[model samples]
Target chain A: MRRAVGALLRKDLTAELRTFESIPAMTLFAVTTFVLFHFGLDRSSLEGDLAAGVLWVTLLFAAVLGQNRLFVAEEEQGGFDGFLLAPVDRTALFVAKALALFAFLVVVEIVAVPAFGLLLLGPDLLDPLPGLVLVLLLADAGIAIVGTLVAGLAIRTRARDLIAPLLTLPLLVPVVLAASEATAPLLAQAGAEGPPGRWLAILAIYDLTIGLVAYGVFDFLLED
Target chain B: MQAPAILVRDLHKSYPSIEAVRGIDFEVARGEVFGLLGPNGAGKTTTVEILEGYRERTAGIVSVLGHDPGQRPRTLRERVGIVLQGGGVYRHVTVRELLDHWAHLYPAPRDVDEVIELAGLGGKQHERTRSLSGGQRRRLDFALALVGDPELIFLDEPTTGFDPAARRAAWQTVRTLAELGKTVLLTTHYLDEAQALCDRVAIMKDGRILTIGAPAELGVGALYRVVWRDAETGEVQSRETEDPTGLLHQLTSAALARGEPLRDITVARPSLEDVYLDLTEEPSAAASQEVRDG
Candidate 1:
């Protein structure tokens, strides 16, 4: 199981490095989303409540960009056949892909989050770094868990164009809501800490439940 | 006691309205290239899928490497390899990189470079799979299946789109796998392929095995076709008979006494394709023959 998971993770990460398509698309999408938020809110209303809303929406669109490009690399190169032929358990394939996606989303956030704070809010929001990273991690995990599984299935469906957004949007709503709420405390409290541990707890629950169910069903759904 | 590589008894699988696999049974012996020859939609793929533990059986017993595949054990999977019909791959990675990733799955894998050469991808190692020609991509698929040095490998229409030369290379690979002591269960629409590579083949139609036998024993070459031109009207005539040699001698001598030379003659033996078609064409005959074989 360890070997299978490791192989899947290695395959995905190596592919990401070779082409670097997903990262650029995601970064550009993330940056564009944040810029859109700035234009919408303007100077008068650029507070933490507004920042929290903007960040969640930015991540949501960025997550979609990353997810959309995820399987295209495999599909374009005709490598999923190799994935299927690997001795790894299919669900491990799921986990490894989710982790790779989680990594990609995190990298983009690392750049986008800070950039959004400094550029859009003029240095005031950078103080929330620690709490913001934790919130992003929790929310990204939830997105990665469900996103990887759905992306795989959607690509195989006849209605793939419509199916991807249809499946992902519903799942993303919960994470987006939770993430928007969690970042509230970071901006509201100066040194005042972050969203209560309960919101993070909700994020954790969502991540764990989706991971377990998706893992259990991955093999049954995806096989040669 | 040792176990058979695969054993299926009265296995049945059904969808909502139609049954795909309708209670067929067979066992693939260890270290042999066993074949399932059938046309499209003939249920061969479904059977192989079930045996690989990819799909569940609606009704039957199937034990592959002494484990039920529906249970999806990593151990059973560890021992088996599969060449899927077709699917996309991770396109961005180079062939070598992709192979390196898969090679890590097994405790003992062949050297990546050696595998690339074996797959006929040596020169294309640094190329992405999407850039490869159809044959090269198929070779990569074959390489992936054999990476783990598995005990049992299931190949479905494994050489469907290959050119003649590539198909020959694939045949050699299958032979090598058997020589190295792997049980291979394969399905192909090409009769000559099954005849040349398969140690034993089961002919299927609808959802049942019409006949199972060595290529020669399956009535191939049992009957011969003889064509000769009649001297009087310069017209052609043909007869299919069991003993073509004997018939040829008698016919020539009879023509000689009558002072007429047999002209424009052709003699041919039955091919595996003919036998396959015959078996499936007569449902009653197939059922009885299957019973007799059992």
Candidate 2:
């Protein structure tokens, strides 16, 4: 199972690296959206709750862009059939795809978050770096799990572009709420403190619950 | 004794508005090539998908390699290979990369290069699948199926859209698999393909098995045709008979007695296509009665 996951992950990462398909588009979308946010509000700098809201919302929508394309190769190319016929456990595919999405989210955040700091963040970026990283990673995990599950469901439908975000955005509202609320304190101009433990717990519980549910149901979706 | 590679008994599948596969039963012996011959909307794909464990049966028993496919037992999956009709491969990846990735899915897989070569994809291994022609894509599908070295392989309409040469090539690959002592259950609408490749075939229509037998024997019991022309009158004549050989002997003897040959004499046996059309054109009275009874 480990070997299967590794092989799949390597294939996806290699394809992404060669084609520059999903990650670059996602990153570019994130940075561009940040610029748009800067002008939309007509604010030179944002802090506290406002700053947290902009960061998570921008990242969430950008993550949706990556999720939309996550399973396009599989649906268009017959990757699902190829994976289904193999002897490996079906959960291996769910794991590999989720991890691949997670990796993409991380890569996008590396650029997007830092860009957010330099562009519109009023607080000293270094002050909140540790807590902010935790919040981002947790939020990314939640997005990756829900994104992969929703992507699998939506990819086979006729209205995939509209369906993917529609299905995912509602499912992800809790993650966005928890992540934004958690990050608000770290971005406060008065000082940087660690995120409240409650939101982190919520994120962890959401990840675990969704991850298990996705793993359990993924096999059924793979079936005809 | 070893069990048959596939044993289906009184199988049925139903959708919301229709019954896709109505009670059908057939068995494929070990190491034999079995063809499920049917037309569009004949429930051929539905049955094959059920056997492949991609879909569930509404009723009846289906066993692939002695295990129920509905259970989706990993042991069964490891032993059976499936090449689905219109199955897709990744368009952006090279042929070798795709095969290599598939190879890792099985515990004991065939060598990636060997599989590529076996599928006749050696020269094009480095080309992205998107660049492949339709024939080449079908070959890649075959390669993926064979990579697991399964004991029983399911090919659903393996050559639906191939040109003559590519179709012949696909046929050769299937024959090669049979030659290697593997059991194959193939579904095709082409009667010639079934006649050429299948050791035995089951004709299906409207979710039912119309008849099942060796291609030569499938519709043979019905009648044989004797065609000839009268030498003196130059009039062509034909008759359907249960005893073609006896009738031909009598005609030849009479011709010999007259010191002349039986002009334009020809014996015509029903091809599988002829039989398939006869059975599938419309459900016979007896078959419809059976459906009503069920």
Candidate 3:
């Protein structure tokens, strides 16, 4: 099972590197959306709640774009059948895909976060870097869990493009809500403070709950 | 003795609007090459999918390598390889890379390079799958199926789009696997392919096996078509007869006495192609007497 997951993950990352299919598009979407927000808000720099809200929303939609392309290789090229034929545990696919999505989100954030600071932040980014990183990791995990499951469900549908974002955005509301709230204090112009622990707890709990649910139901979804 | 490679009995699969596979039963013995010959919409693929654990049976018994395929146990999957009819491979990787990745999925896989050679893909190992021609892609499909070193293999229309040369090469690969004592069950529309490769074949139509037997056995009592040009009338005539030898003897003796040869004297047996068309053309009326063989 471990070997299968490793192979699948390696294949996905290699394909993504070659095609620039998901990560570049995701990062570009994040930065482009930030530019749109800059023009729309007419603000040189923003602090606290507005900064946190704008940052999380942009990242959330960027994650959606990444997740949409997650299973495309398999779904398009009979990769699903190849994976299904293997004797490994079926959940290995789900694990590998979710990990791939998480990795993509982290990569996008690597550029997008600093860009967010440079473009529209009133507070210095250095103060809250470590704490913000923790929040982003937890939020990305929740999104990956829910995103991988929704991507699998939507890929087989006819209006997969419409279905993916529509399904993903609604399920992802809680992640966005928790992430923005946690990051608000860190982005404050008054002083950079660590996120309240409750929101981090909520993010962790959401990841665990959906991660289990997605893992359990993924086998049934692969059948037809 | 070991169990047969596959055992299916009274298998049935139905969708919401139609029944795809009406109650069918057949068994493929160990190391035997079995072919399922059928027309479009004949449920050949559905039945094969059920046996491969891709789809659940509507009702019936199916055992592949002694494990219920519906359960899809890893033990069974480890021993059974499949070449799907129309699935695509990852487009970015070279043929060798894709085969190497698939080889790891099984506990005991064949050497990647040998499988590449067996599928006639040695020259194209470094080419990305996206750039492969259609025939090369199909050969890669064959390579992936064989890389697992399976005990039994299911090939669904293994050579649909191959050129004559590629088809012959694919047949040679199947022959090699058979020589190595692998049980193979393949489905194809090509009657000649079935005739050449299958030890036993089951012809199907509208979701039922109309006839099942060795290729020779299916033509046991079928008529041969004989054509000749009548000397006096200077016109062509043809007859379907059970004994072409006797009919030709009578026709030739009379022609010799008349001092003119029977021109275009040609005798052709009802090949498996003929028998397949005869059975599949009519619906269930002629198929009521289903032929079964051990």
Candidate 4:
């Protein structure tokens, strides 16, 4: 199972590196959205709730872009059928895809968060770096799991590009709610602080619950 | 003494408004190449998918390698390989990369290089799948199916779009697999292909098995066709006969006495193609009315 997951993840990462299909588009979309937000809000810098809201919303939308393309290779290229024929547990695919999406999210955030810091954030990003990392890790897990599930559901549909975002956004509301609420204090102009414990708890719980559910149901979606 | 590779009894599958497969039964022995011949929408795909554990049967028992495919046990999947009708490869990934990745999914996969060579993808291993032509992509699909070294392989219309040469190459590969003691279940509309490769075939029409047997025996018995031209009038003549040899002897003798050869004399048996078209076409108009009136 571990070997299968590793192989699948490696294939996805290598393909991404060669094609530059998803990550660059996502990263560029994130940075551009920040620029748009800066102009749209008519503010040189955002602080506290406004800063948190902008960063999380931008990340969410960018993540949606990645999710839209998640299973496209499999859907278009017969990757799903090949994978299905394998003896490995079907959940191995779910785990591999979720991890790959998480890695892509990390790459996107590596660029987007700094852009957020440079352009829109009023507070010092370094002050809350450790706490911010924890919040991002937890929030990204929830998004990754839910994103993979939604991608599988929508990829086979005729309106895949449209259905992906529509299905994912509703399922990701809790992740957004908890992530934004948690990051708001970290970006406050007054002084940076750790994320609130309840929001962290919410993020963790949502991630765990969704992960288990996705693991259980993923095989059914692969059926003809 | 071994169990049949596939044993489907009274199998049935129905959509909300259509009975796609209605009580069909067939068995394929191990190491045999069995062809499921049908026209479009004849429930060939549904039955194959059910056996592959990709679709649920509405009713009846399906045993693939002695296990119920409906449960989709890992053991059964490990033993069965499938080449689906559609859904292709990762366009951005090289052929070698995709093969290597698929190899890791099975417990004991065939060597990636060997599979690449077997599928006629030797020199193109480094090329991205998207760069491959249609025939090349189908070869890649074939390579992926064999990489697992499955005991039973399901090929759904494996050569629908191949050129003549490629089709012959695929047939050779299927023949080699059968020689290697692997069981193959092939679905195709090409009667000649079925006749050439299959040890036995099941002809399907309107979600039912119209007939099942060796291709030669499946056609109506003693129905040989003789065609010739009248030497004097230059008019063509034809007849269907049970005794082609006797008829040929009498025709040639009479023509010799007349000092003219029996021009264009040829005797042929009814082909699998003839039987298939007859079986599938005979029921359509009546079946449509039955469906409409149901």
Model 1 in CAPRI terms: which quality?
medium
Deviation in Å, model 2, residue B49 alpha carbon: 2.7
True contacts kept of each: 0.73, 0.71, 0.66, 0.86
What tens-digit string does per-residue lDDT give for candidate 1 at B1-294? Answer: 577888999989899988888889898888879999988878999998888766788999999989898877778767888886445345667788877877787767878887787777889998876698877778887787777778998999999889998899888888888888899999999999999999999988888888888887787647788999999998899999988889999899999999989999888776688888876664578789999998
Q: In candidate 1, which residue pairs get closer than 3 Å at backbone N, Cα or C atoms, i.e. clash?
A: A73-B91, A74-B89, A74-B90, A77-B91, A78-B89, A79-B89, A79-B90, A80-B88, A80-B89, A80-B90
Judged by TM-score relative to the true structure, which candidate is superior, 1 or 4?
Answer: 4
Quote model 1's iRMS.
3.4
lDDT of 2 by residue, A1-224 (tens): 99999988988998898899998899999899889989999998999999999999999999999999888888876778777777788889889999999999999999998999988999899888988899888888999999999998999999999999999999999999999999999999998889999999999899899989998999888774
Between candidates 1 and 2, the one scoring higher on TM-score is 2
| Each candidate structure's count of clashing pairs | 10, 1, 0, 4
lDDT of 3 by residue, A18-73 (tens): 89999999999999998888889999999999999999999999998999999998
Report per-prediction Cα RMSD to one decimal.
5.3, 4.3, 4.3, 3.9
In candidate 2, what are the lDDT values of residues B1-294, reduced to their tens digit? 888989999999999999999999999999999999888999998999999888999999998998999988889889988885445476667999988888889999989988888889999999988898888888888898898899999998899889998899899899989998999999998889999999999988889998999999977677888899999999999998989989988999999999987888888887898898988887789999999999
What is the Cα-based lDDT of residue A80 in candidate 3? 88
- Candidate whose TM-score is highest: 3
- Report the error of model 2 at residue B130, Å: 0.9
TM-score of 2: 0.87
For all the models shown, what interface RMSD does each have?
Answer: 3.4, 1.7, 1.4, 1.7
Mind giving the per-residue lDDT tens digits that candidate 3 earns over B1-294? Answer: 878889989999999999999999999999999999999999999999999998999999999999999998999989998986446489888888888888878899999989998888889999999898877887888888888899999999999879998898889989988998999999999988999999999999989999999998898777889999888798999999988899999999988888888898899877888889988876464455553321
Error of 1 at B128 (Å): 1.1
